[model samples]
Target: MSIEVGSKLQGKVTGITKFGAFVELPGGSTGLVHISEVADNYVKDINEYLTVGDQVTVKVINVEKDGKIGLSIKKAKDNPKPSSNRRKSNTHSKGNQDRTETFEAKMNRFLKDSEDRLATLRKHTESKRGGRGAKKG
Candidate 1:
């Protein structure tokens, strides 16, 4: 009921929107669960995963001073990795790390890949145009 960060609580889907879903918490406080936090996979349609009046468990990711709460449905689920094994794996993580991709990480990776692809495309097309700064004879 305190609505502290990292707290998992049962909530009801009060409303759904293009961007996210509104969940009513136990204390009657509502929070927005962004579409990206809806699942581990890409969610083009939030309605497919949630609907009004559906019960859901959410994790309190953030609580703003202005009374805004950020919830995450996927994060509310327990991590499959065992703590002891996870710690051991961390020690050898440099060999082959399998980390969960956060939203920011995915965004940065997408931008980087897009820029690389555009650069390659420009280089390819420039050659067809007789290289840079060339004019018609």
Candidate 2:
């Protein structure tokens, strides 16, 4: 089978490097699967995911004009349905109980929080600035 962009093919890992892994595809063609394309999450070391002679399914992401092939292992796998257990963050929703609180009370709370944040920021910036060439250590 010819290797084309978006095609999923089985390949045998021939080498592994810090950056990526080399896989030998069908018809004796080789492709490089970059570290970033190796997994869905961060990949610090390619050895953790792949090893020499390991068989992996890879997706053809690109074919350079110079005949270089870019492959991806993560994209080759079927995408799993999104989990229902994901935590949906409602950052702005103060909730039904907070609705009972008086508008004045909410305003006061916000103002207090804002003032406290401003004070902390001022302190941090002043410490860093050190005010008028204050003793470089």
Q: Against the correct fold, how does model 1 do in TM-score? A: 0.62
Q: Each prediction's TM-score against the native?
A: 0.62, 0.63
Q: What are the per-residue Cα lDDT tens digits for candidate 1 across 1-137?
A: 58899899999999999999999999889999999899866699999999899999999999999999999988898973345565566558545544665779768878999999999999999999888779566
Off by over 4 Å in 2: 80-137
Residue 4, model 1, lDDT = 95
lDDT of each: 0.88, 0.84
Superposed on all Cα atoms, the candidates' RMSDs to the truth, in angstroms, are 8.2, 7.8
lDDT score for residue 118 of model 2: 100
The candidate that wins on lDDT is 1
Which ten-residue region of model 2 has the weakest summed lDDT? Answer: 82-91
lDDT accuracy of residue 55 in candidate 1: 95
